[model samples]
Target: SGDLRIEMRDLAVFGEESERAARAVFAAGKQDEYWDYHNALFEGGEHRPKSQLDDDSLVSLGEDLGLDPMQFKQDMNSTEAHEQFDTVASEGQSIGVSSTPAFIIGGKPLLGAQPTQQFTDAVDEALARAES
Candidate 1:
């Protein structure tokens, strides 16, 4: 994976609850535990239904990740986190993304949950372009 650099952009296409959870995850990044919280959110399965990601669940996930509960709560509700989420969400929209799990690989849009081979092909194509 050394040849690949992945960046996550949180999009709030789901709704307000989803937006809040997304912001909380970004706030967790401030504590250097983004991936930990991220993994915890999806720990039980490959995909979690939106109904299972309420505000209380989000905070609990943070605490389970050993992030300071009070600090995490404050950060999750902070203006900074809201703004950061907004910025990324807007950027995703500007690029014509209108759904969850949309990916822009090598400046090409790959929408939805794709097969593993599709990802490998995209990465290989991108690598070739980079080398050229």
Candidate 2:
């Protein structure tokens, strides 16, 4: 449960929108080690990017991360991983969220890429409300 992943789905970064680096991260995500790819992108943000996740680069990165190239390839095409990811997305959509990083805390909605302080303050308030 302590897994962190960043997804860039439904994207077609070709032509004028050829973000090869960004696409590479998404392509890497197709593998089980997408988290590594994501963290790498974040760490190297703007310094050097792929503009899109090319297959060759994704494979190379997975190998660089010490992931079994074969397993990573298999997992990428495996229905199990995609289904698991899709289930969460589908559940979120059913629950009135169409965007990313949606949350439910103390029965209240906290949506989008909110700051840590906002969540911390909300949780603190929620605790107070529960106490009262």
Candidate 3:
């Protein structure tokens, strides 16, 4: 239903490595394993260093996940993936989303690490707006 709408955007706010990591996720998406790849990157920990998301590690992770290494590499460097990531990054920057864990609810921007109740309140606010 229209209860909620969630969208994932790639904004390379962390640095070059962050951009590469986002591209890797986009590449995995081509193989229908975006979340799998994304989760694996974060599996080590939430504060996974940029080295962990390097190109070699990303390709290796794809191999571990049974994705064809060659195809994964190609998709990871593909123009389409690059453009998709670049577009989202630019759009997000334009909208002042220059950090991780950003959210836009009911046309209001919420940034940084938020508590559970904050999200609940955002949702309630959104629902209330819809009703009015």
Candidate 4:
């Protein structure tokens, strides 16, 4: 349940930064404040990390979402939290992932953060291959 889901490698940067934030949320998942933090960063239809993804913002999101402030902070910087994300990155690298949002369909490498139609087309092709 406290697992980090990553689809990229070269996490030297990710492991030390972005993943820390995500791990904090995942480890604190039991507090049920995940969605609130998630919504705060994403529901607005834009990720304004400059204003919404900082310590103050994270604290605000946790409180607004009804999570314990102390616990949220602890998990936010916990070594375990960072480690969880590191594992995800390592796994991704081992599996040939070099970027974010990469998908492996029918053993094919599909890179890039594209539109829904692009993904749909890939899925359709993968399904067709499986059927054949």
Write one digit per residue (lDDT tens) for candidate 2, span 7-124. Answer: 3442222331333443444446655556687676456544334433455555566678876777665664456545555565565556666654566666566778899998888777
Better of 1 and 4 by TM-score: 1
Cα lDDT tens digits, model 3, 76-121, are 9999988998899888877778788899887777999899999999
Cand. 3 Cα-lDDT: 0.86
- Deviation in Å, model 4, residue 104 alpha carbon: 3.6
| Best-matching candidate per lDDT | 3
TM-score, one value per model: 0.83, 0.57, 0.91, 0.65
Model 4 spans > 4 angstroms off: 1-16, 50-56, 129-132
- Number of clashing residue pairs, candidate 1: 0
Order of all candidates by TM-score, from best down to worst?
3, 1, 4, 2
RMSD of each: 2.3, 6.5, 1.5, 5.6
lDDT tens per residue, model 4, 35-60: 56655645667645554556767766
Cα lDDT tens digits, model 1, 51-116, are 767767788888888888889888998999988988897888888888978988887778999999
Model 1 root mean square deviation, Cα atoms: 2.3
Q: Give the number of the best model, judged by TM-score.
A: 3
**Sliding window of 10 residues with minimal summed lDDT for model 4:** 2-11
Q: Between 2 and 3, whose TM-score is larger?
A: 3
Candidate 3: pairs in clash: none
Q: What's the true lDDT of residue 85 in model 4?
A: 70
What candidate 3 gets wrong by more than 4 Å, as runs, is: none
At residue 25, candidate 1 shows an lDDT of 87
